[model samples]
Target: MIDNTIFNDKKVAFHTLGCKLNFAETSAIGKQLTDEGFAKVKTGEQADICIINTCSVTDTADHKCRQAINRLNRQHPDAIMIVTGCYAQLKPEEVAAIDGVDLVLGANEKFNVLEYIQKLDGTEKSEIHRSEIKRVREFKPSCSRDDRTRYFLKVQDGCDYFCTYCTIPYARGRSRNATIPETVAMAMQAVEAGAKEIVLSGVNIGDFGKSTGESFFDLVKALDTIPADVRFRISSIEPNLLTDEIITYISTSHRFMPHFHIPLQSGTNEVLQLMKRKYNRELFAHKVELIKSLLPHAFIGVDVIVGVRGETDELFEQSCRFIDSLDISQLHVFTYSERAGTKMLDIEYTVSLNERKRRSNVLHSLSEKKTKAFYQNQVGNTYPVLWESRHNGEFMVGFSSNYVKVERQYDKKLVNTIQIVTLGEWNDDKSALIGV
Candidate 1:
């Protein structure tokens, strides 16, 4: 039995790193703690417990996790520190050994944190509760509101595809999700909670319903029937799983926005094969073309990684040319970083760190041109904008229905409300369309 009195009047602090899924999970954890009589520590205030959710997408991410753990420890010396998430799941002992850490929870154990907190034996030796990734099977659902007007609902978790340079399958385990009805119920609850926009977050949302034997299309259909003003945006989904039928359905959805985020790791089939990606370059291009044909004004974002194990100089140039050929609104570029025990190390060719930065810069410049062009094409067009509660200096910000950022002079009345506005000239960096 756990004692609820121990948690009463205590305070907690949270620091989350990487991805919307992580943010949603952190929020779920926060809610659990707060419901147990713990109050969230405000800015610059110390707490009785600190939870740091770490990411291990790259080596740089691991370093950042360590830095965050240290910074939090120094700031709250008396707090019982806990570490969890992908980093902790991938390297439980390493996280447990971190200075001032009292507990480390793995993917399976994180959801059971309340029980573990009831068993803390102090800092003499940090407690580790980790399980192998292959044995992880339960599907936990999460929904969270960011500092903006958007709510991120975790529809799925984990990955089955063991892409050659990737450790997601190892860190996150197999692809799985809650049933379509359960997921739709979560969305309805978020809508009831005043969510104007909701982003479906997952490691592979398109692969949802693997455990329950339901297709992603079924889930999308159920979410669309929601009788509310809330908008839905799909996060980064695999090109192979993002079928033509799904795109067609979203194009016609009243609740779903005209926005799509797809991951195309490489532009050439050669590099793609080395990475063990499911879809070829031809299939990716066809998907992009299909989206453009159906939703002419859709905001399409693509993810690309530069300088992987087998990407040659000629191949990088070819990839750049292929990316340039796409009608994407923006590019989410990732610079390649070597990870331990991955299949990419066996590949003969490797791009230097400096070379990777150069390749990334090339793609970034191309993306800037693509985005500026996409924004310019929509200038003077009127669209409904959902103003975010978070302020931007003396200005307030909002995103159009099509995912274009628009700004206006600060207005307290505009927070969390949808208003029709005309997009105008680019601001200083042209990052967002000016609201007129």
Candidate 2:
């Protein structure tokens, strides 16, 4: 029988792993618990329930999930353990097999966890329930209201493209998008709930319009129509989906931030072909150049994989040169990690760990230099920063129309407000922009 007495005044802790979408969902789930009279507690403390939102992007993710469960079991052995998210969706059997896990809810059924737990308490037995994502209607809500300043609105989900090196297509099933009216309503709701900025996120944001007759452009147009005091930004888009028209539209929209993060897995055409990326280096360069031409101070972040199967020193150098030759503001370098059931895992001639580390370091060093240079260029420019809560001893801060981190002295009033601040010289070797 479900034990309603256990959660009468109990506390809950959530540990989230993965992308912005996962964090948004976690916040939503936490809100649900809080609304039901359960108290939200910090991690590492003893609690009545522990929810772990997992990722399956890389093999390291799997290892970390297992390690986290083991640690949680040691700390709070008696607490109910719940596992959900991509890892849970992909490998429910493996997760349910873990000794301390009390429940495993897959992607489609995870949102209804409270009811499941209620029933579980009545039965006193662990439960496993996962519905295939393909047959579902994207059950979760589209808006996020937990954050005071920024909200991640999931405008799209799942992916149809089966990139040779990706497992998202299998884990998430197929491409799906929220209707234009529904997405705009959520954006407006977030704005009403004190959100100063909205970030549109998804698996493949560029393919947002394929399922519906609406395009990303249409979504942006509708969002722009919302008379909100908040700005908007996109998470990541494929080179092919990031068309010139979209770039031009963002350039003119007052609410759209001048930032774009496009994933360029590899710079060399041969490596890109092997990775099954749709666009080559030349087309990727054009997209960056077009964005820059439209908005000079725009922050163009590129996602590059350092070491994939069959990567040579020459190929690595080519990748580095391509990035060096771009007008991008920064780089998000990822060392390729093999994922189970992905085509790249079965590819012959894998690079050694040391080689991968070396390439990763090289790209990281270059990224630092590029980032510092970008900050240096903004020295005299004044931008609007949306200040966040305090970090270590300093106040957590955000960037302007273009994404640049600027830190200032602590101010409680600026927590969720956008203020105009001038960028000063680099403060430390950390390359953080000091605000004046």
User: Candidate 2 on 1-436: residue-level lDDT in tens?
Assistant: 3345556687887887888888878877887787777897765568888899999888888888888877777777878899999999888889888878989998887788788877675344567889886776563655564443678988888888898888887777777887888878878888877889899988887777677877888888888888778899999999999989999999998899999999988889989988888888999999988998899999988898878997888988988888899988778888888877788777797889999999989988888888888878988899888887745465465667788888788878778889998988776655468888
Candidate 2 local accuracy as lDDT?
0.83
Taking all chains together, the TM-score of candidate 2 against the true structure is: 0.93
Best-fitting candidate, scored by TM-score: 1
- Which ten-residue region of model 2 has the weakest summed lDDT? 139-148
Tell me the tens digit of each residue's lDDT in model 1 across 51-156: 9998999999999999999999999999999999999999889998899999999999887787898898764799999999999999889999998889999999
Each candidate structure's TM-score, on Cα atoms with residue i matched to residue i, is 0.98, 0.93
The ten-residue window of minimal lDDT in model 1 covers 425-434
- For model 2, the stretches where C-alpha displacement exceeds 4 angstroms are 1-7, 42-45, 121-126, 137-139, 145-148, 391-396
